[model samples]
Target chain A: MNALLEISGLTKRFGGLTALSDVSFGASEGAITGLIGPNGAGKTTCFNLITGTLPATSGTIRFRGQDIGGLSPHKVVEHGLARTFQAATTFPAATVRENILRGALLRHPLGLGAMVFGGAAARDAERKARQTVDEVMEALDLTEHAHREAGTLAYGHQKRLGVAIGLATRPGLLLLDEPAAGLNPDEVDRFATMLKEIRTRFGLSVLIVEHHMRLIMRICDHIVVLDHGEKIAEGAPEAVRDDPKVIEAYLGADHAK
Target chain B: MSMSATSSAPAFQPMTVVWIAGIVLAALIPWFTGSVFHFHIAIMVCISAMATGGLAVIAWVGQLSLAHAAFAGIGAYTSVLLVTRLDVPVLLGLPAGALVAGAVAFIIGAPLLRLRGVYFVLITFALNELFRLIMLDIPEFSGGSSGIAGIPKISLFGVTLSNYQSVYPFALFCLALVMGLLVLIRRGQLGRRFAAVEENLALAESSGIPTAKTQTIAFTIGSAIAGFSGAFLAHYVGFISPETFGFQLSVSYVIMLVTGGRLALWGPLVGALFLTPLPEFLRGAVEYQHVIYGVVLIAVLRFLPRGLAGLPRQLSRKGGRG
Candidate 1:
């Protein structure tokens, strides 16, 4: 029905450096769409622009047909678009469960019932969060480490927790920057499966940036390649894989430049 | 396993009887001791601790506010004005001053809160200077540099507190009230969201926790508590001076929170108690007390990054992270 997220001719710049130069793309509901590029190709910058973490230099970002440009990051989430950062972002002092609960609790405006007493609302919210945490952990196979301090997790798990926290928001559009960045091969395979589960189970539409080509090629329904801040390729995975521009961007950088 | 929880709420359980024992010990200190002067200093410590606990919210959320003392000044002056000009009962002034402080914090914090990181810090520093200058101009209201005088004592439920003699326990009561609020916030979702914003603002925002709004709400609440403390302190002294609410007072607040542990509810109290007694303890060498305090702070900052209550936990976390 509704195309989940629509970004048209979006441009963002940092001082003189044009980080995202008129990049345009769309991701539909229930599809795993990938944004792939070499380092400094502005994948994360595009993400920042979409999530409203960074103001777009110019152009429109419409989430389910609503213009979401210039809103602060929290407002972006409120509008049903959520994102996972490239950095290992977690409340280091908190347990994995508390981290997820914080995300779940953010859905409410007043947080009235939960804020006051050890009242029913607070307990209900917490129980729901605990259930979601358990389900997400099961899906990600991180159940055993539920009570562990988030900072103590291996890098890959911490990265997944960032995504889990985002998933807890139950966003209509989930933008993930480099979800598979530092994972080993086995972990990447596991994460690809997790991504598929996230999409299917949550009915989520995803826009992901991953430098890990194998994971992208395996799980993505479609792929878009960016070269020097421009969308160089976008198509079904097979066609995009054989793309000469994608090839040059990834493999033949020096000569192509 | 926390040792400072005062309440019995299961979900937000703090350490119970142990903390009560500690509070009981604190209550006996003034009665058991000889010097009224030391008791006065201890009372100051309690008041300052309560105010700094409020300031901790601002500091912990990465907002450095040098205008805490100024907000307290607003509270103190408001209390004085209400008592002197309006002839309001002194008890009315406490809540009135607190409400004004909260209102002022909201007004000032709303605009300046758009400034992040060190910009927030600088704006607050300038705000302290501005507030002092404003006090200077409004001589009719604040009594200028000479400040307000003959401000009456707080009469709680019809019992008029005598300055110095009776105010020790009243000041201590104010300290308890402020800390109790702090403990509630610290154990709740608001506190968690605040900490989340500090850890990763972008992540917090993406998670739909309005980071800036959270900071502003915290600032408002914190400033309100500071005002409440200010109201009590002003009446306790029976006088108010702009100098008492200057930038140095802000630093003193900062020093207390920083030394105790900005993250912990008790950190501000510990910092105040530790530093408040140092001048008296060194007595004849009062001049060197602050110098040594400065050196000690440097040493702690270098070695104990998270303040005293947090040190052992930090080490254990480092071990676990490794």
Candidate 2:
């Protein structure tokens, strides 16, 4: 009831190495929550765990206070939690419109007859896809490239399309991993404004993983710092940045530097 | 996928459409051509296209299925067995064969769709051999290696079409229907979803396109087409041997698709049109016709990565840059 998503004592192990252990976090509704850490901080592994790309070794993930652990990846999306990848995951050959339509395929739970023949359910899906396309394209300023192959877009546009695809599933909670990872400063500024507008318009509770200090500090309401697969600090952005453990995790020892 | 044809290759050229039209036209062959014997071979190839279209789906998704021939065999045998044993009408038998084939594909897809890359092709190749063995091992149903003879031709409303006259147009019509369905699948929401799964399963899953479900749909559709073709094929020949839908048939279907280019719908048609006639045309040099065919496909693959339909676009890209 207090959170849209609740994870308790989550553990993930790959053979001898534990990628994540005893990790617990809760995400509230309609707020931008930032998860930040140094490289190899297990930020992505956590994303993987919540999205069910990798099953938890042991733990509980509850969405809307209902246990959703051990669900299939597609079912995770169906539960109204969608995620973007750290690496850009745009389909190279499909046009931007097609790339987005694939996301809209999840909006309905229609069966084979509707899927095959484009019955009323299929037509309804198309209508929704077109509307979502118009909305996201305007939000992300990608309408001009809507018909262009996603791969041919500029690197920054490709990154935005990746986010747009995540947005397409109409997630109650959206997870963005490194949205501004490969963008230039100018593009990052533009992305920040777009990101703000998305939160305002869609009313989505966004859990974004970012390393860019400026973007996170400016946009995140609350911040969680991860250090070597451990939760080192969690607080308001200003407080987390000032925390000693956060500084050490990011900067490492001054002597070593 | 991009609408920027950016080329001067007539009005309708952007790779996928050309192949779609080509395969569709393969079904329309009997309408124009006059020779009854030509109709016989063309109808056979058209049936071959149904199975190949299914293979095209598998290959487009970066999966290879050597047991394509096996599914065709399953379809042919199922319908043959049904017609021979149950006295079911040919119309009923065709769907029956397709249903059995689809069920078999569902079972195969459950296990094989999980394998990675070329591992699937290897597994399918083994399955093709296994199916042939099963056909021979079960003599009562399959008639052993001898196969079932005098399998009834496909008929409608009690009208027997067991000859070249009936089977040729029927095969062509079925081809058209299958191609139409494939085009719709490619153009429709599910079609795009399958392409997405083929292009990137991880991205597809993250985007909420059910990967397993989409793969199953594609496999089921592909298998159904294969089985449907087999039913028509059994009747077209008025007899069937397990050998007809075996390794050589699988190789030919893949060759047709590859020579034509895999994603292009027309690829299989062009492949069948050219390859189906070449050996017969050079009957005197029959010993080396297949070698020539292989050499030609090699040249095409090297030069036109998109297949025959891709040549003009590739040339124009060079021409524009030049």
Candidate 3:
């Protein structure tokens, strides 16, 4: 399958500290790719660069065969790439439905003039947006909590809401940042199953940044490991799990030996 | 189950009727009292509310601007010059003022909005002062400190509103138009976008909302409204001066916005209604008028953090629990 997202020679530096160094990977269309790394392994940095949350020091990020590097976050999303935050980021005060609606509206965005002087087109767009929001919420099991404020949600639900928001954007490629970070074992299992279900249902390509090895290993079709901002290993989950480089990165070199 | 609440349809509530009645009664106050002074005060409220409405738009995007008064001044000057010099009709001049003010906001907003929070406020404050000094320097247009006097009154189709009563209705009409526009915007998709950007800029951006552009749009609309109100004030008051739209004017607008509910659509109107006639009532203690204003502002901030417009919501939330 052709790659939905391609990153080559990606590098990010914060003055003296290099956050990501010449890391490169491609997420295939209709497949789940896991980016696993230890704390400070530059996994989040990769997500940020891919989503245009931060400017890359040097690299090219291609989405759907077009260069999207250095574009604004909104513009990157407009290119059919959307991302969820490490934390369950949302419009805290807005209801779950409202939060998802904001994301869904991106699909049927009305111009300032069109919004102010609304017509049939605007109404149609809004109707379509609401439909998308309903579908997204239902798929994410957030339909029941639609009226609840996102900030007031339970921790696991909030994480699911984050994914719901990303899905609402109708993205071809979805990047999730540590989605299962704080979930309990049962929640993680459910989340993993949901991820797999959504991947096939939506026909989406996913690049997930996660430290939860079991969850990542269970769901990811392919895995890439990063250590000290560099790609240490890349292959199927089983191969990457046994890679000495990945083991050393997760555990210390002494522990690995 | 449906997201119909996100749509613009007004859900039936008893409070809605009470609000409409209150507004209608307030609008008819001048006629009820049969007093020219009441008419004048009512007219001032309309203009102040309109300007404050503009400020509220900027506030909606979670940015407080001290340059609001400057935009108003830009409008005032633009309208005054257009009418006095080029012989443009007052009706046309009003919108001209809005256009110029909005244009200025659009130009500066891209760079200016980059500075968030207090820094944005400080820069805007400096911009307001700069506007005053520069206008003062250009006495040929601004009439120096003494200012322009005997400006023409608002004339529609060659009918000059020569009296306070006539002008009051016209001002009310203009206020209604401005408020209507505000309502249209608030009920539309742009309002949702504004809410998203306001609630969380980062999330909004990632959600494919162009936050910077959204903010600039809000600023432009807000400043344009300020401009229209400033133009109206110039024509009705029949004077133009650099000091008219100064730091004090901006601060008063902020106070009104904060006192009413920074994020509420009716905040500006509520603030203007409550505050404009206040000094008139406190005429006995004229010297302590601002001190009283300060106290009221502080008390409101302390208790009604969402401002007066949010009072209903706060009370209802409390009621629901109790």
Candidate 1 structure quality by residue, lDDT tens digits, A157-228: 899999889888878888888888788889888888888887888888899898887888888888888989
lDDT of 3 at A167: 96
Query: Number of the top candidate by lDDT?
Result: 3
Q: How well does each candidate superpose onto the true structure, as a TM-score?
A: 0.92, 0.92, 0.97
Model 2 achieves a DockQ score of 0.47
TM-score of predicted chain B, candidate 3? 0.96
Report the poorest 10 consecutive residues by lDDT, candidate 1 chain A. A108-117
Chain A only: give the TM-score of model 1.
0.92
- Report model 2's TM-score to 2 decimal places: 0.92
TM-score of 3: 0.97
Which one is best on TM-score? 3
TM-score, structure 1 vs. true:
0.92
DockQ of each: 0.53, 0.47, 0.75
lDDT of 1 by residue, B159-246 (tens): 9876565778778777887877777777766777788887777678788887777888889988988898888788888889887798
- C-alpha RMSD by candidate, in order: 3.7, 3.6, 1.9
What's the CA error at residue B250 for candidate 2, in Å?
1.6
lDDT of 1 at B68: 94
Question: Which model, 2 or 3, shows the larger TM-score?
Answer: 3
Point out the worst 10-residue segment of candidate 1 chain B by lDDT: B1-10
Model 2, A103-188: lDDT tens digits are 86678656676666777777776776667766777787888887789888888888899888888888999999999998999999
